[model samples]
Target chain A: MAVTRETLLAFLSKKTRADLSKIEDGAELFSSGVVDSFVMVDLMMWLEKQTGARLNPADVNLDNFDSVQRILAYAASRAR
Target chain B: MSGKPGIVVLGSPRSGTTLLRRLLDAHPNIACPPETYLLSAAARFLHADQFAAGLRIGVLDGLSFAGFEEAEVLARLRGLTFGFLRDYAERVGKPRWAEKTAFDAFHLAEIRRLCEGHVKFICIQRHGLDVAVSLRDLVDKTGGYVQELHDYVRRYPEPLEAMARAWIDTATAIAELADSSEDAISLRYEDLSADPAAQMQRVFEFLDEPWDDELVGRALAGTGQVGFGDWKTYARSSVDRSSVDRWRSLPEPVQVKLAQICNPTLERLGYARIESDDDEDDADAARRRYEFGLLLNRMKNEDS
Candidate 1:
């Protein structure tokens, strides 16, 4: 169940109106103005459901969920 | 007065003020500028000269002063600020003008002095913890550093408490100034969320405007272009009512520090002292606090 970049991108695409093509794997979501606080909750819920992983506030750091690639990586790590 | 009544919607950030502003703006007779912060910034300038330097560029159009009489400068500044608001309103094609600004809550005296008999104030209140959670969510979504968020909480302390204490403080302070002024009303975010139509009708009544059901309905339906885009994936299905006590959800040490810092104001606003097991009493005290506020308003009117 290793999450791939395409799967993460598709999930994000389905959830938001953002142009995912512009969202680079390493770009900062907040600095890039691609997301805001209200959307973060929805994203977390979607991720939890999709990957069957529970995320706590402490777990909500840049390493695991900064961008699509990072999210996929985080999900893959959890799956392993 | 040459036009419809001017309204000032005041609250702390993330207190549902923006949503309320949009709702009020939906009224055909009303127009609001986004977070003008004129009076608030002026207060900060009066207290701290350094802030004036930064604010002059963004808000004061590069205005300068080289040691003029403080009172005279403030008076002149007030006039300039009011002029800006009035002119903006005129340009917007609406006779009634409103401004939604957070810092304005901290500058009640200046607001009263400037607007005087001219403007009405709408105070919007949301639970402070909810606001903090919202702020946390915002910082996370925006990819702000956790360290920065921790720093802000450490600096502002009680002023940053999520429940409506700051809103209540500002409203109470303004209410004190607005005694017999006939130009201030307080609205709760919970009531509005529970029943928008009823709450809106009350808002219109308080503002002395005719209620338009259709306009209110449209505003409720219109989320605007906000909270869209990539962020939409992160939207919470609904705000967590229980999150109002999110300070409890923080690490024990963080919660202890926040409680210690916030206890005095929290007690002043009728929040229970945040011991480990004060949840039920805290909620009750919060409810009583708002009830006393309504009572205070009634008592003031009776005295008047």
Candidate 2:
């Protein structure tokens, strides 16, 4: 099952309690203080379930998971 | 003139050594460097099985072959290591130096010989369960101190069990050292954090140093944050009881496991064994603890 952008956005929106419209697909989450590292751990775990692969600690960096676009790319790469 | 008896602070990692180091460093007569691993390294060289593979001899024998007698080796090693610390003290206009290093408890006999019987140890012990919890959180979050913990991990495999074993081993070493040596003193982390001034005064009395409110204030202020130790101390201004029994927030299973691993040593050290029977809310409590730990990390990052 592919992780849809909308689904990821919905998860982030619920975690941040922000409107879906406020968060950009390309906007930085942790770097911008929009989402904390704790939420990032939750998101990584959620992504692991969605992607069916254990996310490598090396791959779990700010550059890869800072935005929805980057996270989706990471998930898609793992799916491949 | 022969130097004064040296002070060495011994404790397992995360057992409030950082707070203790800063407090000792604050004293006008003593200079305590942050997280000096020199003593542990000295202990290793003296006791560890280091062989010269090609030469088919022990490393100490090889050193002997290379014209360094065991006594001379220790004398030089002590001079070279503690020499730097003494210089650090003098540079700062202090007369004495103390070193707080991890794993220093494991080889107290060697440390005693290395320091040529002119050393005093202040061993700090904390509750075993709380130490396991703190060690787990520290490894999970920062990926720091892995090298120091790797040997225990290899033996125990289970992370909490490894941490519990570390706490037990350190406490046992400290107890034996205190029993065998007159210069060694032990203190509890709970008591120190709860009433820092009183505990510090006791420490001063043990050291035969002058003590007063002014020294205690400087220690509590904890100004210098130089070397590699306890990033948390850099955020807080003074020690508090906030971290005394952190194991209570962890799941019952974890508490029980840690308690079981170190109960004998814990009881020996006057810490009550944990009685965690509540099972219904273990999962909920663990989740809350996890989130709280994360929130704390976030807050600390923000503060710094």
**Which candidate should be chosen as best, given TM-score against the real structure?**
2
Off by over 4 Å in 2: A1-80, B50-57, B65-67, B106-109, B276-304
Give lDDT per model, in order. Answer: 0.58, 0.76
Backbone N/Cα/C clashes per model:
13, 0
User: What docking class should model 1 receive?
Assistant: incorrect
lDDT tens readout by residue for model 1, B1-304? 3466578876655566766776787787777666676776665554433364465332223233454554566568767776777787778776777777755666666566556566777876555555555665665676743332444456555434533344345545644554455677766666666776788888889987888768755665555434322233123233224434555445333455556555654455445766642132255434543443354344334435
Alpha-carbon lDDT of model 1: 0.58
TM value for model 2: 0.68
Distance from true position, residue B181, model 2, in Å?
Answer: 0.9
TM-score, prediction 1: 0.52
Which 10-residue window of candidate 2 chain B scores lowest in summed lDDT?
A: B276-285
For candidate 2, write residues B162-209 as lDDT tens digits: 888888887787777776778878898999888888988988899988
CA shift of B124, model 2, Å: 0.6
